[model samples]
Target: MTESSLFKRTAAELAEAVAAGEVSAVEVTGAHLDRIAAVDDAETGVHAFLHVNREQALAAAGEVDAKRAAGEQLGPLAGVPLALKDVITTADMPTTAGSKILEGWQPPYDATITRRMREAGIIILGKTNMDEFAMGSSTENSAFGPTRNPWDLDRIPGGSGGGSSAALASFQAPLAIGTDTGGSIRQPAAVTGTVGVKPTYGGVSRYGLIACASSLDQAGPCARTVLDAALLHSVIGGYDPLDATSIQQPVPDVVAAARRGADGDLSGMRIGVVKELGGEGYQAGVERRFGEAVEVLGKLGAEVVEVSCPHFDYALPAYYLILPSEVSSNLARFDAMRYGLRVGDDGSRSAEEVMNATRGAGFGAEAKRRIILGTYALSSGYYDAYYGQAQKVRTLVTRDFEAAFEQVDVLVSPTTPTTAFPIGEKVDDPLAMYKNDLCTIPSNLAGNASASFPCGLAEEDGMPVGLHVMAPVLADDRLYRIGAALEQALVSEWGGPLLDKVPELETA
Candidate 1:
């Protein structure tokens, strides 16, 4: 395990090595930091991270080393480096939520998951960039700038968690945290050839996560492998009394499930092919790759069948309504009187005027667009017609999932309709951008567990395609099972992880 190759090891492998004294925690952390320094700031680099907590990360790693040296037992992910999305609050670092409004705002406390990661001895490398307020499909809406796909520098990494996905794909970190309001986690993973999981809503505590759509927002693991994501998932998931909506159930044994799935046997499992999630608009290569993945599932002895979730057609529209309506209410806290950015507050303008100026200047275009859309949907006159109706549609989508699950252990689809699209291609086309979440939104709407696993590269552009898996609310282990099976088959076929094909980034 030479230092130069340390960044390429999975979190599981690194943790095992560190625990066995094969490598010091500082050495592991330093390898990642060195990797970040070498490639992250290059002229055409990934630019995945918004901030790198060099001193804090190294110090945390040192503490882990001390604990290990003292013969104390450490968590499974101890000494593993992780990239956290900017939306999650970190007291020591800024929690900007990728919007200029919260830029440079230091949080008062760590997000529950953040604290959990520290407790597990996971070193927080830095905050990754995202779409402002987690409102866009591509990271182009990030106030700082877009996160370029590591697959092709000119392409968009899936957003609002693009930074995390990019970090994994570029080998800057072995693990990362991402929030999926719609498809923020899964879509990015699909585009970048990484693994992302959106745990069941309320499965992971959201105490310090900056609100997106409170009902829909979920923070989950992002990694290069199914097992690695599951390992991270186990550490951050469980009940948190601080979060009112936190589930009161024990976290599922996802790591064990992932390990079990690696045997490549799904003899008794039943899988469903989502009829609504693919077809007419789906790219040829995506559909082809998805069909092949489904075939692989069949070869693994799983019963594959097509299931119809008819209401899924309306998921995009309903999601836009519900998400924005919630966004309108949640974002109201950013008024000029409190923390974050302030404008025209030099003791002259009225409070309302100050708030207007601050938000106008602070929020990026997409954030403003969603806020207005949400406000309009929730407005007195349109509340019943827009927001209320959308809620009804949401219920139907949940019913669709319920009905589908009764027939299958898990549902599958192409995570995104297409591969990574070129940046600037759809920034001005909001509707086109929103379409990216078409397949992923149904799960968020229903608050079920979902994830994206790298299946293989699309022939059209030679970019990655993700196999999306949706499981019942508490049946998150099912997702990892399916993902692990696919991952094992795919890795064997590709001769390695799909990300191994990514072109090497030039070091600074």
Candidate 2:
């Protein structure tokens, strides 16, 4: 492959070249870094990266090259360049989780995924932007600024994980890590024309990831190709002693399943369509594209059946309550007493005042809003009416997923209800903006495995809409298999990657 083209090659292709000694690890790392440098402008502005650790990256590349020269065997992902979301801790780079309160704070330890990537010889490119503490549905809430969509800079890249998706779509990196609390990975991937996966709750270790909503948070891989996601997932997922919630089982062979589906025709794969996920609330273009996706899956020998999760109607409200309640609790540790920037601590002031002053100054408005909303919900008189009831609703929503998965090998829906909206459109309306995650939030709530891949461009708007494939909890490989099958079928049918439709970037 051409030098200019190698950086854009699929993860599998890159792995082959690395294994065969056709490309040096340092060369590949440099190429990706050059690409990142090439288009990092206000116009092409894929503001995906927060703090890039070029020194560490180059150092890692050198070690990989030395290993190759010594004839030492390497893992499948050796020499790959990967992006880390700010939410995930890294020893070399400061982990901000896209909030000013935690700015310039580097952890003494690496996140489990970060540590795993290093062990597999993958170079860390940088930390990506996200919603402040992953609280918003779009990256617009990022304290560092929003990551513009790779497809159309005028619009948003999906939130929380938007930075990772933008980086992959822009060819800045082949593989990246992103978190999904409420469609942060999948929705952003959909808008940017890349692949994003949310493995089952305990599939990927959450040891060092900053908590947004503990029960709902998960870290997963994001990439341009399904197999690339699988590779990264394999590297990062497994049990960790640090996270009590981590399930210590071997993560199924996600890459193997993806590769198999890449070649295997989608025969006998039963797909259940969630009636609640796509319909009246969906944009016409989204619906049209989803319909085409259904047709494509059907033609590929997949049996498409309609399934209903009636409790889905309550999902949005329930998630808002539960998430804020958790956030209110989780963020309490960031008071002036410890960590990051502390603004207001005077010797005369009481502890509570210092906390109030510190939090009031450090937190952004959206974060403050959620904290207040959560406090109100968790208040003694309202706890039963709001937070407690939301927990019950979560159980119902999860049961619906269990029942649906029993009926089909995988469940399908539009990754988002609409294509990417203009940057500021929903920034002011939290509720309306939160609705963008309607199709994706349930998966996080239920702790199931889900993958989002581009289906086709939206007909009315010409923007891309994604098709989501979700599987049972701990059956992450199933999502990858189904996603890879659909990805290969659609890419082959369309004759190439979906970003071919994206407007040309006005590189600096």
Candidate 3:
């Protein structure tokens, strides 16, 4: 295949071809690297990566080729090029969460997913950028600087996982890793016109991922197609003894479900349209496109019904409270004396002075904002009123999802209220910006499987609109099945990925 053809194929398609001996792993890796060289330096500079493992990737691809020659057993991802969000630890590369504090710090070990991806023989592309500590909905909060949107360079690529989404959308890489606490993974995918799946919280092990909002943070897949996402998800999901919350059982066969969906079916699924998320704050085109997605599922012989989730109204405030509190606790590990950036005089400085200088210099404004908010919420008399009450609200939100799931197999909504906005649009107004995640935070709090795939393009802005699909916790494979089915249906009508038809940008 030509290098551009290699860039354009979905991760699964590339993997399948490689596994079938139609192509060698080295050629594919080379093509991807060439594509990254061609565009990653330019105007739609996705900045998807914080570090590029050029030598490591080439070495891995070479080994894959040698293994096949030796007639060794091979995994499906044997030749695939993929990225790890910098938050996921990798012994060979730095694992900064887009923060200056940990800028050049490499972990001594790999995360469960990072290890598994390596075992599956996927080539390591690099570490992608993200919001500092995965805190914001836009990568503008990243210490490495914002990842620009590929569709329109002036706009955002989405946050927390913006770099991952932008990487795949721009064909810099066919697949990448992302951690979603609130809407980080899916929202970025929605805006970038890619597929991102936030597997049921704890579906993927969190032992080595940097903590964000601990209860809500989930490392998931971002790719060009639903089946590609399924391929990566299936490989990464399952138990890890090191992660306390990991489910003890093997991950259900998510890949098989995607294969089943690709067979052109969705017979008896009960897909619920959440009544509360459809109107008001949502943009006209978002709701319009979601309505069309419902229609697609209906045509595929699935029952789609509107279900009410009244408790969702309280999800946003509760999330901000809970996330900050966890962050305050998790970030304490970054104190200057222990690890990361250390500031102040080595011998003369007091412990408190060192910490203050380190944190003040290392942390971005958003990180500081959340840490301050968290510290205050957890302090003295205010603890009972803020953090405690937010926990109660979290419990209520979980119950809300349970109630809705009882009536429907999977819940659906427009992924975000709108398409990608200008890069700096929401960064200045913290509260107004956090509201961007209003539709997304509830599912994260509930510890469920959520997926965002392009439903259609927006009429007003000609940007991609995403439809959110969710399933109960641990029923993750079902999400892949339904998501793949819907993806196939939508593609049948719209032809191919929304970005394919849009004009490509001139490089810087």
Q: lDDT tens digits, residues 187-292, model 2?
A: 9889888899999998889989999989999999998888889988988889888889898799999988998888746787889999888768799988888888
Distance (Å) between predicted and true CA of 446, model 3? 1.1
- Error (Å) of candidate 1 at residue 274 is 1.0
Q: For model 1, what is the alpha-carbon lDDT of residue 150?
A: 90
Lowest summed lDDT over 10 consecutive residues: which window, candidate 1?
Answer: 38-47
- lDDT at 288 for candidate 3? 90
- In model 3, what lDDT does residue 459 have? 86
Backbone clashes in model 3, listed as residue pairs = none
Number of the candidate with higher TM-score, 1 or 3: 1
Question: lDDT of candidate 2?
Answer: 0.87
Score every model by TM-score. Answer: 0.99, 0.97, 0.98
On lDDT, the stronger of 1 and 3 is 1
lDDT of 1 by residue, 1-508 (tens): 7876899999999999999999999999999999999877624688899899999999999999999999999999999999999999999999899989988999999989999999999999999989998888888898888899999999999999999999999999999999999999999999999999999999999999999999999999999999999999999999999999999999899999999999999999999999988879999999999999999999999999999999999999999999988998999999977699999887888998999999999988888888999989989999999999999999999999999999999999999999999999999999999999999999999999999999889898999999999999999999999899989998999898898899988888
Predicted structure 1: lDDT: 0.94
Worst lDDT window (10 residues) for model 3?
Answer: 37-46
Query: How many angstroms is residue 388 displaced in model 1 relative to the true structure, after the best TM-score fit?
Result: 0.9
Which candidate number would show the highest lDDT if scored against the true structure?
1
